[model samples]
Target: MSLFRKITETVSKGVSTATEKAQQTVEVTRLHSQISGKRREIEKLYVSMGEAVFRGYLDKDLSRAETKVIPACEEIVAIRGEVEALEERIMQLRNEKECVCGRKVPYDTRFCPSCGHPFPEPAIPAAEDPLEEFDRQETEPSGLSSADPFVEPPGYKDPGEAPSASDWADVGKPVLEEVPSAWSDAGQATPSFLDDADAVGAERADSAKCPGCGTAVGTTAKFCPSCGTPQQ
Candidate 1:
C-alpha cells in the first residue's frame, strides 16, 4: 500500500510540472506577440512621420517639420553615442581594439595586420618631478618690494629735475605754450583766436535755414519766410 501511494505522488508531481511549463510557454508566446505588435506600430509611426516631413518639404515649410524631427534625430544621435561608448567599454574589457581597416586587434598592437596601418602612439603623461614644487618655493621671493623703489622705467623723470627742451625734441614732442590764468593778478585779456571762434559759432547759430525752402531764417523762426511752411 505504501509503494502504491509513492507511485501516485510521483505521477501527480510530474503532471503539475508539465502544466506549469505549458503555462510558461503560453505566456512567453503572448509576450513575443506583444513585442512584435509594438515593433509593427513603431514601423508604422516611422512611415507616418516620414510622410509628414515629405509633405512639409513639398509645401516649402520644412522648418515646422524640423522642429519635431530634429529633437528625435538628436536623441537618436545621443543613443548612438552611448552605444558606441558601450562598445568601446566592451572592447576594453576584451583587451582588444578596432583598427581603421575594420579589423579587431590586440590593444597593444602598433599596426593593423590586415592593412598595415600604423596606430598612433598612446599618450603617456610626462612624469612630475618630485623636487619641482620644493625648488619653486625656494626660488620664489617671499615678500613684496617698497612702494617707491629706485627702478626707473623708460622715459622716467626725477620730480625736482625740470625736463629740458632738447629732451622733448629727442622724443619728437611739441613744447606746450604756457597759458595765462583767467584770475591772475595781471588781469590778462582773453585770447583773440578764442574770441573769433565764439563770434563764428554765434553767426552759425543765428543763420538757421528752413528745411522746406532752404532759405536762411532766424534761429527762433516758426515758419519759412519764402514757402509759408512751418519751420522745425
Candidate 2:
C-alpha cells in the first residue's frame, strides 16, 4: 500500500509540473501573437500616414494632412510602447535578457558569455559642475613669450642703416642718352638720327617741282597753279 501511494504522488507531481510549463508556454505564445498584431497595425498606420504625407507633399501643403498624420503617429508610438512591454514580459517568462549582440543570456548574468558584452551599468547622479569640468584639462605651455624682444628674421636689414654703393650697383639705371626724342628743348643737344630725318624732309621740300609745267610747287601741292597741271 505504501509503495503504490508513493508512485501515485510522484506521477501527480510530474503532471502538475508539465501543466504549469504548458500554461507558461501558452501565455508566451499569446503575448507574441498580440505583439505581432500590434506591429502589423503599426505598419498599416505607417503606410497610411506615409500616403497622406506624400499627398500633402504633392499638394505643396503639409498642414492639411497633419490631422491624419498626427493621430497615426501617436497611435504608432503607443503601439511601439505596448510591443516593448510585451517583449519585456516575454523575456521575464523565458528567464533571459537580450544583449546588444542579439544573444539571449540568463537574467542574472553580468556579461554575455557568448559575445563577452558587458551589460549597462546603473546610472550615477553627477555631482561635479558641468561648467567647471572643462577646467580639469592640462594645457600645453606656449613656446613664445610676451616678454621676449622681437627677433628679426634672416637677411633682414635695419631701416635706419644707409645703403652701400654695391647695393645700388645691382639696381638698373635709365639710359637717357640712348633713347632719342624729336621734342628735345633748344638748350638740350638733339640726337644725330633726329638731325638726319629733319635734313631729309627739308631736301624733299626744296626738290618738289611740277611734272607737267616744270614749275616750282610746294611739297604739299597736288596741282601746279601756274600751269593748271597735275604735279606728281
Candidate 3:
C-alpha cells in the first residue's frame, strides 16, 4: 500500500482502539456501580432480617430474606466477573503491536515487513580487530638498544667524503694523437722507389744492380750506369 494509505489506516486503527477502550472503561464503571448497588441492597436486606428476628419473626423473615438478599449477592458476583473480563481485555489491547504500515505485527518481532522499521536492538560489546591489535603491539618500543640491526653505527657517513683528482688517475680521460699519412713524406709527395719497395723487396723495378760490376742500371739500358757491361 501507499505511504499515505498506510498512515491513514494506522491513524484509524488508533482512534478506534481509543474509542473501544473508552467504551470498556464506561462499561467497567457501570459494572462497579451495579456491584456497589447490589452490596447495598444485600446490607439493607440483612438489617431487615435482623430487625424481623429481634421482633420474634425469624420464621416469617426467612422466606423473604432468601428471595431478596441471595439474588442481590449473585448479581454482585456477576458484575465483578464482568469487570474482570473487561480489565483483561484492556490489558490485551495494551499489549498489541502495530507497524507503521498499519499492519498488526507480533510483539516480539524485530522488524516490520511493510514499513521496514527495525525494533530497538540490545546493546552489545564490539569485537576488536586482531590485525589492528597486532599493529599496535608492533608499534610499542622494546626498550632494548640492540633491537634493530639495520640502524647505522656511529661515525658512519652516507657517501664517505668527496674524491680528489689523484684518486681517479687510473680512470682519467685519455689523450688522442694525430696519425701521419702514408702517401706523404715531410708534407711532400713520396718517391716512386719508396712506393714500389714492397713489390721488389725494397729494390726499384726500373733500377737494377749490375751483377758483374755491382753498378746500378736502368731496365732499358744496354750497359750498366757505372760499369761498361754488355746487355744481357
lDDT of 1 by residue, 1-232 (tens): 4445555897999999999778766665655565556556556556666877998999999777877676656655665565566556656655789978687777876555455566777899998787997899888986766774677889888899988988777696577765544332446765558878999789888878768767766666555445545666
Report lDDT (Cα) of residue 58, candidate 2. 96
lDDT of 2 by residue, 76-120 (tens): 899899999999999999898997878776675555544456676
TM-score, cand. 2 vs. native: 0.47
RMSD of each: 42.0, 46.3, 56.4
Q: Write one digit per residue (lDDT tens) for candidate 3, span 37-142.
A: 7667656766765665555454654555555556656765776676556545544555546556665545655555344566565467899999999999899876
- Write down the RMSD of candidate 2 (Cα, Å): 46.3
* Candidate 2 Cα errors over 4 Å, as ranges: 119-232
Task: Report the CA-based lDDT of candidate 2 relative to the real structure.
Answer: 0.77
Residue 194 accuracy (lDDT) in model 3: 74
**TM-score against native, each model:** 0.33, 0.47, 0.26
Indicate the residue-level lDDT of 179 in model 1.
53
lDDT of each: 0.68, 0.77, 0.62
Lowest lDDT sum, 10 consecutive residues, model 3, at: 177-186
